[model samples]
Target: MTSEVRAAVFRPDDERIADAVDLLESLGATPVPDPMLAVEPTGATPAPADWTVLTSKTGVELAAEAGWTPTDTRLACIGPATADAARAEGWAVDVVPEEYSSAGLVDALTAAVATDESVGVARSDHGSAVLLDGLREAGIETTETVLYRLVRPVDAGESTARAAAGELEAALFTSSLTVEHFLDAAAERGVRAAAVEGLADAVVGCIGEPTAATARDHGITVDVVPDEATFEALATAVVERAAPSHHGE
Candidate 1:
């Protein structure tokens, strides 16, 4: 008899988690929906600048909700997903980095904009410093607006316990912050070491290179990082690798 393939997902506690669960079920894996991240809006908007950069879909949504528009500023997104989100709000997206990361954004902007222009970055409080540092090093004046803060939810340790108990067949990590929150939850439950041990035996997948590096730095063995840094890609790759074991094939 085949055992159920239980996979853990660490998205925010929102519709994204529901979408992830549906995707996992369609892929034949039992979804372990543990929301390790929570969004706390800072109620601030980006100041007008020569160039404006947005990093996440959530930032775009928050900005739109606050009635902030990129009227005259040239807009650049860190990835296609954020660009799509901005476009959905009737904003003209001028540039989307080909690489879909902080470094990618820096490269795209540096090549497109002059050093004399100022850049405004609007993202989460946990936004990576690579983009700002790279832009500044290129002699472009840059400022950041914290659109929101990502905090771990209070009731987020179920997956940590499951992983430590050797019940999860796979784990999907979306960002470096999610990885950190998972470890924090595990440590809170006193299962940090055991959970890392269990992850060694399971297929662990991160959305991108930076997230994979964060997992590796914390002693977790990462098994898959897809070319596209998207949740669909991460979950698909992880389920494909973990399904064989659950099916006893």
Candidate 2:
């Protein structure tokens, strides 16, 4: 049997979807384009702070819509991709932690802020406020503004749902939203619990702990979690997990 890897990507753009495909192909897996969610930017608002934290490229795009420039404040990004987006928008990134999670970013920022420095965070309206909460506890005045919202795709196909129902070699999840949206889309397409059970036979590869936690909460067994939550790391984990086990030999 051919080891085909069908991924349910939530990104709508063809370029991003292609990137996911490319990443999967590099690991000797086939990429299936089934975006479960779409990202919509809400109107931007006035930013009020000396420093700004950006967790996603959508947040940066929203900042641009709000007439907010990265050069206007000290910019801190959660990871390299977000930092690249900030730099593309002419913002100078001052800090990007080794770990790519919100908690890691907060930990890095907690050490950066001394006293009386105000910071702003650009995030999704419904996402976690761990960074903002942590900054406040560290004595730094922090404000959070919603930049974008995630909505379920209008037409998640039945083929994708059926594929998810079968025994998957593995599934790679990038965010908590992906896990939630996948389940929602699956249900909308009438995929049942047996399909989710079939997925359990394969390794559940997550980009970070938070996403892994989300998977676990849904009763999905997470078999692999990358040490670093980056796209490259995710691809590497997929390849590594597919390798033959040495223990049984």
Candidate 3:
């Protein structure tokens, strides 16, 4: 490769960075682990429901870790990967939103399922209230639980230094928290403006539109987003889109 073309892997704790790192490496860019967020168990027991919703793979993993075995509850996941995670835990997914966002999930469930059923949502401690709010607006009662905790790692803006040096060529954002904390960390390091410019200049990829919205709200341009919110697909999309920039050299 003509340039190192480092891409920031901005997911939480590098939990799912391997596949994306491999993909970026195959495309001739070195993947830098920029784990800006960390997750911890909240120790809060999740309530049961006739319909249960999971927004992230972490939620599914943590729920299963907490010995939450699905009884007769119908599972609704926010993305295909999340559905896969739910299935891996032995529960069949009843609904997955085609748009893969809060409003989309609520829309999908509103049209397809009976609204009177008891619904529950499991997510991280800082998970958005969007889905729960949207569902309630749609007349569906949802009990929400913080199944895990999300925290900004103390080293959040470690990569913003690279960013200031113009070394962050691209990045992948998996959640709103990642985008939020990445900026928070960058701002914490007193390079928020430079980091914002650098991110704007870099090829920004999001696993879903919700995250893209977060980036745009912060004035960062989003270059790639996958139809399916899977890490492999997002990584591939970013690489494919970055090819003409000589990233695959």
- Report clashes for each candidate as comma-separated counts: 0, 1, 0
Q: For each candidate in turn, give its C-alpha RMSD to the true structure in angstroms.
A: 1.5, 2.4, 2.4
TM-score for each predicted model, relative to the true structure? 0.96, 0.89, 0.89
Candidate 1 stretches greater than 4 Å from native: 245-248
Q: Which consecutive 10 residues in model 2 have the weakest lDDT in total?
A: 240-249
lDDT digits (tens) for residues 46-151 of candidate 1: 8789999999999999999999999979999988888899999999999998888899898999999986899999999998889989999999999999999999
Q: Tell me the tens digit of each residue's lDDT in model 3 across 1-249.
A: 334567888776654766667777887777888787788888765587888888888888888887887786888898888899889888888899888777788888887668568788888777677788888888887899888888888866777877776777788888888888888888788888888788776778998888889989998899998987777788888766665454534
Q: Relative to the unseen true structure, what is the C-alpha lDDT of residue 148 in candidate 2, on a scale of 0 to 100?
A: 81
In the range 1-249, model 2's lDDT, one tens digit per residue, is: 434555444455546667887887877775656665577787875377788888887777778777878666788898998899888887789999877877888889888866878898878876676777778888888888878887767775443455466745667777787788777766776674655776676656888888889989988888878887876788677656754451132
lDDT score, candidate 2, position 78: 88
lDDT for model 2, please. Answer: 0.73
Give Cα distance to truth, residue 95, candidate 1, Å. Answer: 0.5
What TM-score quantifies how close candidate 2 is to the native fold?
0.89
Candidates in order have lDDT scores of 0.92, 0.73, 0.80
Cα miss at 215, model 2 (Å)? 0.6
Tell me which of candidates 1 and 2 scores higher on lDDT. 1
